[model samples]
Structures are given as structure tokens and as C-alpha cells.
Target: MQGPPITIRLLLLMLTSVALMTVDHRQNHLDTIRAGLSLVVYPLQYLVDLPSAIAHWASDNLSARTTLVEENQQLHARQLLLEVRLQKLYALEAENARLRELLNSASKVGEQVLIGELLAVDQDPFRRRVLINKGSDDGVFEGQPLLDAYGVLGQVVEVTPFTSSALLITDPSHAIPVQVNRNGLRAIALGTGEAERLEIPHIPNNADIQVGDLLITSGLGRRFPPGYPVATITEFEKDPSQPYARVVAEPAAHLERSREVLLVSRTAEEPSP
Candidate 1:
């Protein structure tokens, strides 16, 4: 039975809602009842929202973790690059030091000198030779003298347009004229295919040579300049039955380790006294 018109029913419902709101706002008469209703509905509301809350939390945490990992990897890569650069800087410092030594030696020789870098070392055990970057194009010629900072290294044996080969003083086929610095007794130093050994053959049994004597170039053969160091006497042996004494010397130049060397000019000035 429709006892009331639509307009009358709407007005009555509005009046009832306003009366309940006024009472709840002033006297708080519906507080307990409202609280009980909220308690009953809270679990349903949370249940409906749980999936979205979980999704938001997981997305935020996972994204933050991914960002941190990426940043860490980038930092690690940068550190490795810096370390490599540092190592290169160290190598450059050592190279500069070696160049400085070569320059000083050049100045001491008081001659026109050209600097050359070693390209390759001879692999043959019997040949102690090295290839250099300087060649005939750079005024390098056969029999040109090569010297390191410490002493005479060798002489150029072969020259090309862009490269040259040097026979080290330790090669079995190499020989240099050297003299004792103490008494000026001249002798020939012969290589033995050993890095550290040079033999002084034809020394008389009564020769005045002694161990620890410095051997310098004697300006003979006109190949190497005078007064340049060659080696130091290390061992001397005399056999009464033999006319010559067996003498061994160690090279002054670091043949096995030098990376740069100087080539003396053909008309080079005399070395400093």
C-alpha cells in the first residue's frame, strides 16, 4: 500500500537524517552504535584494500632496490677505470725517468746523439742483438755506436730505411777494444753469448790486469768512442802452461733491461775527461 506521496516520503527521510545527525553531533548518543557498526565493517574494508596496498609496497621497495643495485654497479665500473688510468700514469712516470737518464748521458758524451727505442730482441740464444726504431733514414749507419745511460751497449750491425739491428757486446761474435783504467793496458774483450760474460783472450800470464778493474773503450778500431765504459773485470784465471790468461768481465750497460739508447754521431766529439 502506497500510503504517502513520493514528495512526502522524501521530505520525511531528510527530516529523520537531520535529526540523527544533530543528536550525534551534540549529545553523541549514536557513538557506541556507530563504533560497533565501524568495527563490523572495518575488516571488510581492509580486505578489499589489501591487494592494492601490497602491490604498492612491493613496487616501491623493489624499484628502490633495483635503483641501488644499478648505482653500485656504475660506481664499481668507474673505480676500475680510474685504477687503470692510475697504472698508466705510473708507467709514464717510469718512462720519463728513463728518458731523463738518456738525456743526461747524451750531455755527458758532448756529442750529437739520437735517441732510439727498442722494438724487438733477438730470440736466438747465440745472437744477442736487438732491433731499434732508428735506421739509415734517421742518419743511422752500420757500425754506429749505441750506448745506454751507464755505458757502451753495442754497435749497429745492420741498418734499414726505418730500423736497425745492434749486436750487443755479449754476443759471441762481438768484440770491442778495451783497456784497464788503472794501468792503461789494452786488451780485446770478446763476447761469449752469455748476457753477463765477456772474455779477454790473449792476455799474457803476467798481465797487470786485476779483478774489479774498470774497462773503458780504447779508441782503437775507430768504431767506439774513447773513454766510454765497457765492462768491469769480474774473474781472472792464469794457467802456467798457457801463454794467455782467461779473463771474464761483466758489461757496464744493462743489455738485458735497457729500453732506450743513444746513437753517437759519426764525428762525435770526445767524451768528457
Candidate 2:
């Protein structure tokens, strides 16, 4: 029993001496000894790490097919959804182009029309203006009229080198001359800063205008073209003894929601006086 205990003690002492020598050689001024020991131990390090590397490679190889299949399915579904949307967009664009062509022909004024894309709406809800992707270079001028496919949108308020700002007809400061299409009753449609509505001020209480009457630009001031749709009478209130009637009309064009518009050039062919 004494002999076995002495042998175990000697083994422990030898292991502790080796660990101390390794630490000193690696950390202190013994590079030559450290390099030699590293070369001897390098094979064991590789052997320990080899199983983990092999397992990782094998796992990737086995899952590659399933991963590819799932990715392919997702891509195909996205492609199908985009294709359907594209088809509808194409049809809508074609219809818009045809209607614009007819409008240009019917106007007979020969004004060169430039199509502009809406860039942004004003951050202030009270101000009804939009930024467009056209400017002086595209023949857009300040005070030039803008219109959508349905009717008048607004006038150019600010012109820049690359873009311009349009004040919509619903702006609080905007007003346009309009005539009721039903009975040719002329009135001024004033913007109330409401999103899709305007107010007709100073109309007599017994005016011929009805709740469903259509209002079109009368072209009296020549700011807007005549016969262009402006608004539709939506609400009207008349007090028997009041001096003026209270009337509200909804705009015919998608003033707040329109994404595309035509910037009518001010250079329309003038007829001889």
C-alpha cells in the first residue's frame, strides 16, 4: 500500500512540473522551446477539432436540398403575385392614355400637355397642395392650370428647376368661377380647406341651384377652361329669412388622391383676334 501511494504522488508531481514549464515557456522569454512544443502538440489539436468540422459539413450537405426547395417555392409565389398586379396596372394605364388622347383632341386648343407624376402632398392638412415631378424645363409655368382625367386639379403655385408645387382647388385660399350645369347659374366655388369639398358663397337663398346640380368651370376669368367639371352640389341649407344660402359641393376630380396629372402648357395656339 505504501509503494502504490508513493507512485501516485510522483505521477502528480511530474504533471504539475510539465504544466508550469509549458506556461513559462509560452508566456516568458523562451520562444524556441514554445515553438518546438507547439509543433509536437499540433497533431493532437487537429485530431480533437476534426470531428466537429466533419459533422458541420455533413449536416449542411444533408439539408441543402430541403432548404433550396423551400426557397424556390417562396420565390415562385412572389413572382405570381407581382405578375397579377402588373396585368391590372397595364390595363389601367392603357385606359388612362386613351382618355387623355381624347381630351387633347376635344379641347382643340392645341396646348402641349406634359404628364407629371405626383411626388408628395403637403404635410399640413389645411393646405391642399402637391409636389409634381415637372418644372420649368418641362414647360411648366407658374399659374399654369393642372387637370386630372376627370377635371381641373389646380394651378402651379411654385416653379423650380426640377419640380413644382401645385395648389389644389380645395386650398383655403383658392377660388374658381363655376356655373351650374343644370341651369347655368354662375357662382364662385371657394375652397374651405376641407379635403374633398368646396363652398359656394353669396348665393341667394332662393337660388335655382339644387342639391344634385353639377358645377363646371364657367371660364369667366379665363384661369380655368370652360366646361371642365368642378364640383357637385352635395349639401344646401336655406333659411327663409336669411340673406344667403349655405351650400357645399364635393369636387369631381380626385384632388387629394390623384397620383398622375397633366400640366397644361400656357402656350396654347391662340386664335386670331
Candidate 3:
């Protein structure tokens, strides 16, 4: 049970370690033994490191997936914004085309004209009227004629500081003096509360009017300028039993579709015959 004292045992162990280190350093005696020990412990070292390696791999994968998700969301939002902008561009292109057509009509009118955008349309089915953006401040006066690209649209009936109301040619209370462009036969075109139809009353049964005749403003009333297209006769019926012939014509202007119109000045002189 008894052994050497503690100081003597510690000195002996230190001497042994020094001797082994000297032999390993100078004679390379421990290289074979060190290789054998490393071979035996390599699997144990790998096992000990496996959990930390797996944790690092999992963390990298999760971070990559989160980054991809965020990038995808950003791209989707960008795509939606681009689509909205493209739609607006298309609308603007259509508006520009319409404005060009208005300019062409203005050139043919040979009158001082102001472009007016439609602000509102009357909701009443029987009343074909629309509100325009220009008014007295813009020289838009009552009885001022309105025209679209194709033909006469209407006349301004009410005016305010910044807006005006116009009665379309198809309104029931509206009437315009139109004559047959083919034969100079005079007739009155009266609105019948229909969007496309105008009734030409008081045409004699023996009148020279026929179907497919073009009707133009006769400049008789002085309300509208001369030689402006108004309507085309679609139906002409002669009834011997009736005193007047039944005539129906379609409006030339796209009253229900025009979004922009021209407010024509009243000073346009009549065309020379």
C-alpha cells in the first residue's frame, strides 16, 4: 500500500516524458506509433464532428430558401405593376388616335373649334344628352354646334362657367333641317327618342326621296352650318292611303360612342355654291 513520496513520483514521470520527446524528435522513433494511434481514432473524430456539420448544412439550406421566396415575391409585385402601366399605355394610345380624328374633322369644318371632352351622359334612356368640359369661359355658347369625327353630334343647349350640356340629335325634343344631298329635296329630321333612328315627317308621297339618300344640313335654320352630314335615309315607304310618306334615317355621328367632340364657332360662313 505504501509508495514513493509525491515529489519523487512527479520527478520520475517528468524524466520519462522528456526522454520520450527527445527520442521522438532526434531518432523519429514515435512516428510509427503516432500513425497507428491516428488510424484507430479517425472514425471517432468524424463521429464527434458530424452533428455540427449537419447543423451548418441545414442552416445554409434554410437561408437560401428564404432568400428565394423573398425574391419571387418582389418579382411578382413588379410584374403586376408593369401590367397596370401597360394597360394605361394602351388607353392613352386610343385616346390619342381619337384626338387625331377630331383634329381632322376640325380642319374640314373651317371654323374656330375647341376640343371638349365629355364629362357625363344623361342616364335617362329617352334623353340623349351629354355634359361637356368646356363652357362660357371657353367661348362655348348655347346653340353652339358639336361635331365628332364623322358628322354632327349635337348642339349646346346649356352653358355654365366651366361646363355645358348638349342635346344629341337623337333626343326626342331635337330637330334639324336636312335636305337630300342627291336631289336637293328639303325635309325636316326629327328625333324619335331612338338611338339610331330619325323620323323625317311631312315628306309627300310623291317626293323624289329614295332609300340610301344622304341627308346633309341645308343651312336653312342658320343653327347649323351648311353641307354637314346629318343622316342617311334607311327606309322610305310611300303609302297612298297616308298623306305623308314614312321615312326613317340613321344618324351619321356615333353619338353613343364619342368621348371627345368639337365645339364649333357660329361664325363659319356658308360655302359658295
Candidate 4:
């Protein structure tokens, strides 16, 4: 009662398929019947493929959204980076302009001049001083003249190994000899502890000075070189009680805003015997 041998059964089925194919080829058998069967099974075939179609659609939509989101984030980051670089470029342009002016002004000294950057500013009320980066190590010494792009800034009063302190012309204790650029009238310019004011202690009533006169270093002290600008005569008034004329001058240097300064390497000298 066992089934026929496997090889024999396979051979029999193959022969039957061949016979059916020969008959169908000759007589067009099963043509109408096959059409009817396909019609009946078409709905089932479509039903089986629906899940795959929906899954493919969901996957494609999710992938596109994720890609768009990633691209948007990358674009935003790139824009921010470019903005930061542009700001830095603008700042550099302004700084370069300032440096060019400083170099041009230093040329007036006509002596060996060293450039120094500001380090710190004192907040003390009594002493108005600033520290520069160069010091004794850089050939800076006491009484070394400091100049900005506009005019004389200050003079180095103290020097350390790597830094030096400068006393601005606006300090109360500082004094410089100045002369009117128009007339040879010499006078002492004294700091008034004010940023914009310097007081000339005693100007004779008959002195040939007027508003708008440019003040230049007289070089009498031998501490500063000759022909450097100091301040401008802004006001002059006469008081009946006071013997000296009241005069106020504004500093030529941008004392509060100077970031870089030049130090004249000229040595301070004394009159020879």
C-alpha cells in the first residue's frame, strides 16, 4: 500500500504535463477557462500586495522628511558661521585703518620709535596712569615719550621687566613745557586732573596768545623731542582779581581711546658743562 517510488512518480507527472501542453497548443484548450480563473483570483492578488505598497509609501515619506530636516539644520549652521566671520572681517578692517594712521604719525618723530600696546589703565582717582606692554626689556626707560596717532599721549614714568607705567598729560601732577605754534610764546601746561582740560598756571595778560593756537612741545626740559604737538588753546579769559590770565587747553592726543602708542627711543639729555 506504500506510494510509488519518487522517481517514477516525478516522471509520470512530467509526461502528463507534456501531453496537456501538446493538446493545449493544438486545440487552444483552457484558454477561456484560464481567463475566467484569473478574473476570480485578481482581487486576492491585489489584496496580498496592498500591505507592501503602504509600507513602501510610508518609508519613502519618512525618509524624505528626515532628509529635509537635516538639510535645513545644516544650512542654518552654515549661515551662522558665515555671519561670525563677516563680523570679524569688519573689525579687522577698522583696526587696520587705525594702525596705518599710527604708523604715519610716528614718522614725524624721525627717530627710532618702538610701537607698544596698552596693557592696563589705573582706576585710581589721584593718578591717571596706563601700562604699556614694553618695558626695560625693550629699551624703555623713565621719561620715554609716548605718542599716539594724533599727538603726544604720555611719558613712561616707571619701567619693569616687561611692562612700563605711563603718566598721561591729564594727570594732576604732570607738567610739560609748551609754546604757541603761531608765536614763540613759551608756557607751562599743567594737567588739571580732567580728561579734556590742562591749565596754564600763569599766562601774562600781555601774552600774544589766543584761542585756536596750536601748542607744541618746547623741548626745554630735554625729556621730550622737539616739534611734537601737545594741545590746543581752547579758551582764554581775564579776571580782574587774578594776576594771571585764565587759560584752558584741550589735549591733542586721544587719551581715553588710544590703544597703541609709539615710544621715542631718543635719550634724555642735560646741558653739557
Candidate 5:
């Protein structure tokens, strides 16, 4: 055959040179030259890749509807599973709440009571107050005693048109007349702004109080019903030379955690005097 045309021969020589350069660069023998050439060709390489990128983007855009449908189905299935679990949880919670109410009702032998839900907790860190869903409209009055499944929570402090506020016994401003269940030693349990503890002040060092003793409302002030639990002695410090012992008690009621409460009405003979 006749010798290849001059232009074709030159193009073949250029291609051969490019291949040799590529091999040398891969072997790290022509790194500097290859890096310079790459920099020079970078814009051209990007321009060449633009067509393939556009094609990929168009393909994905065209298939978006199908992809979205598949993703939506997956999400709906997950939502259904979550909703079923939520239903079971709600049922369990309701059943537990109803059982607690039954227990409280059985314990209050002669008192009239109305069940109320805790609406909100006090925002002030200093005052221990809880808002209940009941108010004057529901026969809820100020000073009505609030109780949970275990013991006294507090008493109604303020009654609004549709809601009532309860001042917890753990409020610093509140104090309940209490007695040691074991020895029947009477003392006032004063709130110290602590959520779960109370202070029994002026208890004589010789008093028979001890750790683990149960403190119950003595009903001396007639504010709280008699025999209702208030706190349990958790710490007792008796100094032989001191006149008074230091006693710390933990509240027996779930005052800070309970979601429901019972508003017990005063007995007919026990009306406010």
C-alpha cells in the first residue's frame, strides 16, 4: 500500500506519544510533565464529561416518579408498624391507670372523691404546684386534698373557672402535721423545696424516730385526713448533746411524677370550721 498520508502519520505519532506518556506517568517516571499536562487538559476533560453527566441526570429525572412511588410505599409500611405499636402502648397505659384508680377508691372507705388528671407542673423552681383539670365547675374547691395511689400529693391552693392549682406538700411554704407510725410521735413535716424529701423540725433527740419509719398525716391541723401517708424517714441523726435530731424523709407519694390524682371531698362532719 502507498505510504500513509502525512496528516494520518502525524496523528498516529501523537497518539503513540500520548500512550507512552500515560505509561510513564503510571510508573511515576514522568510525574511532573504528566501533572502539567493534566492541568492544561482539565477544562477540556470536564467539558467532555458534561454530556455523560447530562444524560445520567435526564435518566434519573425521567424515572423519578417510579422511584418516589417505591419510597412512599416503604415509608407507609413503617408508619403502619409504628402506629400499631403506639396503639398497644396506649392500651397498656390506660389499663394501668384504671387499676391505680380502683386501688385508690378501695382505700378511701368513707370519703367522697373525684378523679382528676394532672394538667401541668409548676414552672417556678421554688414553688411546688400542680394544675389539675378540675375546678369549681366540677365541685373542686381550694384546700381540697389531692392524693395519688400511694399517699397525699398536696392540697388545692387556687381554683379557677375551669382549672385548679394544688400546692404540693413539698413546697417550701407548705407544712403538714405528721406522726411517726411506729411511736406515734407528732411533729410538723416541713417542705424544703426538695421534690422528694421533707424536713421534720424540732423533733427531740430522744424521740423514737429512726430511718425507715413511716410518717403519716396526723390530722392535727384538720387540713389533711388522718392516717394518710406523707413521708418515710430516710435519714435520722441524733446527737446526745443536741436538743433536736435532724431527720430527712422522702415523700411517699409520687407527687412529682404522678399524672393523675384524686380530689377527696371533706366529710360532712369534717367541714371547714
Candidate 6:
């Protein structure tokens, strides 16, 4: 016998809930159970609210203009540090390249060269000369050829016991015999009394010279080392009426800014002991 109808089941469920509630209230039997359940849920409630606390702290930190300024200053300092290191690397690379060229020049000349340090540049506007820290005491003599890492610069003209003066190839009174590196057409390169320019005064209008010819020492005067660079032709002009071409060149040496030079004692340029 299926004992109860649907309505009867529902009526019985209501009466049992009411009787349980009345008993719990009279005896306080459920109080410990409710407290135990509250304790278990407290940690979850705190966890759900943690996001708001973190957001409030971050907002306060970002609101201050002073904090942004401090961060920008730190970034600038780091950038400057890197730039300074880059400059040092550039200097080291230039120095290494200059040393390599000096070694090559020394090998090609096949002479004993004494290193000369610049003491002072000549102040006279009419002369292109410099004083070096080598003299008779260092075996330096007049007409001794001076060169830098690049090429022939000048010859020592006056010497003291401890110092000497070199007249640059750009001096008005200086001249060197040179030949075209490509064809060996000989000419005399005369200084223009300027620090940057030289001239070949008597070049034939139809000479084998070109605008970009290299002029190395021709060993004609024997004052400069043969095969050493003297200048580079930059311009060649010929007038129909004139018999010669006006050839101008730039000095191969760093005439305006050399800090060091080599004093080569070739057989013909050196003074006898």
C-alpha cells in the first residue's frame, strides 16, 4: 500500500521542520553548529575583498608627481652612463688605428726613427713650423725628414741641444720633388704658404697628371724618403693661352693638427757622426 498522497507528504514535511525549529530554540542545540559554519566562511570573505585593498594602494602611489620625477631622473642617469662608455670605445678604436699606421710607415722607410713630441707650434704667421722635443742631443739635425703616421710632413731646419724646429712642407720656402704614383711624371711641389695647399708650378698643360693623382717623393732632392706620400692633387686647370696647367694639391700629412711625428735618419738626410 503506497501509503501517502502528494498533499499528505507536503503537510508532513512542514510539521517536521516546525517541530525541529521549536526544539532547537527551546534547547539551543543548533547554536554551536551555526558558529562553526561562520568560522569556516570568514577566510573566503576576506579573500574576496583582497583585490580592493591592493587597488587602493596602487592608486596612492601613482597619484604623486614627485614619484614620476624620480623615476625619470634615474632613466636619464643610466642613459648618460651608456653614452660616456660609447665615447671611450670610439677613442680607443681611433688610437689603435693610428698605431697600426705608424708601424707600417716605419717598416716601409727602413730607417731608425726617433719619436718626437711637439713642444709648441710656431706662432709666426709667415712660417709654417713647429718645435719638437728632440735636438742634437737626440741625434736630430738640420734637413732630417719628419713624418707622421700618414706621410711626409716636413724637415728639421734648426736644432738646439734639446729641441728642434721643423719647417712644414706647406712653408712658402719649402719644395719637394714628387712623381705621379700612377705614371712617374716628375714635378716639383711648392708650398703655397698655406697650411692646406701645395702647387706644381711648371706642369705642362698636357702632362700625364690627373685631378686625383698621388704625389710621392721622387728621390730627386734626396731630402725626403722615396715612395713617401707628399700630397694629393685636387685640381688641375689649363688655360688655352698658358703653357702650363695650374695643379693644386692638398698636403698628405695632417699639417694643421699633428701631435706626434717621426724623425727618420735616412742615409742622405742624416748628419754625419
Error of 5 at 55 (Å): 15
Number of the top TM-score candidate: 1
Clashes of each: 0, 0, 0, 0, 0, 0
Worst 10 residues of 1 by lDDT: 264-273
Question: Which of candidates 1 and 3 reaches a greater lDDT?
Answer: 1
lDDT of 2 by residue, 1-273 (tens): 345687798999999889878888788756777799999999999999999999998999879978999999999999999999999999899768756754654365446677788999998977999999999888788887788777788899899989999999999999999999998999999998988889999999989989999999897776676788889999999988889999999998878666778777644453211
> lDDT by residue for model 4 over 1-273, one digit each (tens)?
999999999999999999999999899997999999999999999999999999999999999999999999999999999999999999899888889999998776677799999999999887789999998989998998899998888899999999999999999999999999998789999998888889987897767889999999998888777788999999999887878899999999999988989998873344311
lDDT comparing candidate 5 with the true structure:
0.88
Off by over 4 Å in 5: 1-95, 98-107
lDDT on C-alpha atoms for all candidate structures: 0.93, 0.85, 0.92, 0.90, 0.88, 0.88
* Candidate structures ordered by TM-score, highest first: 1, 3, 4, 5, 6, 2
Q: Which ten residues in a row have the lowest lDDT in candidate 5?
A: 101-110
lDDT of 4 at 157: 92
lDDT of 6 at 238: 88
Using TM-score as the yardstick, the better of models 4 and 5 is 4
lDDT tens readout by residue for model 5, 1-273:
899999999999999999988988688778788799999999999999999999999999879978999999999999999999999999889869766775656476468888888889988999899999999999998889888878889999999989999999999999899999998989999999989989999988878888999999898878888998889999899878888899999998987667878888888889682
The TM-scores of all predictions, comma-separated, are 0.80, 0.64, 0.76, 0.72, 0.69, 0.65
Error of 2 at 52 (Å): 25
lDDT agreement of model 2 with the native: 0.85
**TM-score preference between candidates 3 and 6, better one:** 3
